[model samples]
Target: MNNNPRQLAFIILQEIHRKQAFADFALDKYLRKNDLIDANRRLVTELVYGCVRRERSLDAIIDELAKKKSHQQNPDLRIILHIGLYQLSYLEQIPESAAVDTTVELAKQNKF
Candidate 1:
């Protein structure tokens, strides 16, 4: 679509969060449906799987960061936290500011 890699990742995360679909299946289906090519397709692949794999730990970090006793947030916020923390913990090549800003923006846009 018109969105960048990070934005696409965020949208995919939301879809996975909302649809209750398997991340791999959803990502694969999405990849095949979209016009993503070459490295960007690879980025989307990594983005989806990486975020899904580390979802629990990401939730813990986000709960801690938000100073909460537990992760009792909405599913959309869960998606946001998962991607944000995935980038924070693993995607070291991407700047932390970009990750956090985009995650917050995505959450806001989704009304999370």
Candidate 2:
């Protein structure tokens, strides 16, 4: 699995989505498996929990901005959007460009 915090968070979110897994459990599972620095671990935890907490709001935002509604989007793509938007909307310290660029890179990495 990728060690990038965003990528790790994305995978945790995907597992939550596809397996109906609990967010905390999935997050803990991944965190245990990956050797992340404290900051990266916090970032992964924040991204996963924040995105899960704000899922409906994120979906609404995606619906408003995307030609495809959130539900209509590919699951992976929607998760990627959630990661990016979560950072943009909630993480004040993260530069907007970093969030957008990293999310775009994730999409490319996944061949979306």
lDDT of 1: 0.74
Over 1-112, each residue of candidate 1 has an lDDT whose tens digit, in order, gives: 5335656777777778777788888777677667876887877778789988887777778767775533577666666677777877898787999878977886777676
lDDT (CA) per prediction: 0.74, 0.95
Clashes of each: 0, 0
- The true-structure Cα RMSD of candidate 1 reads 2.3
- Name the candidate that leads on lDDT: 2
User: What's the TM-score of every candidate structure?
Assistant: 0.78, 0.97
Per-residue lDDT tens digits for candidate 2, residues 1-112, read 5679998998999999999999989999999999999999999999999999999999999999999999999999999999999999999999999998999999998898
The residue-level lDDT of candidate 2 at 36 comes to 94
Kindly report which residue stretches of model 1 are placed more than 4 angstroms away from their true locations once superposed: none
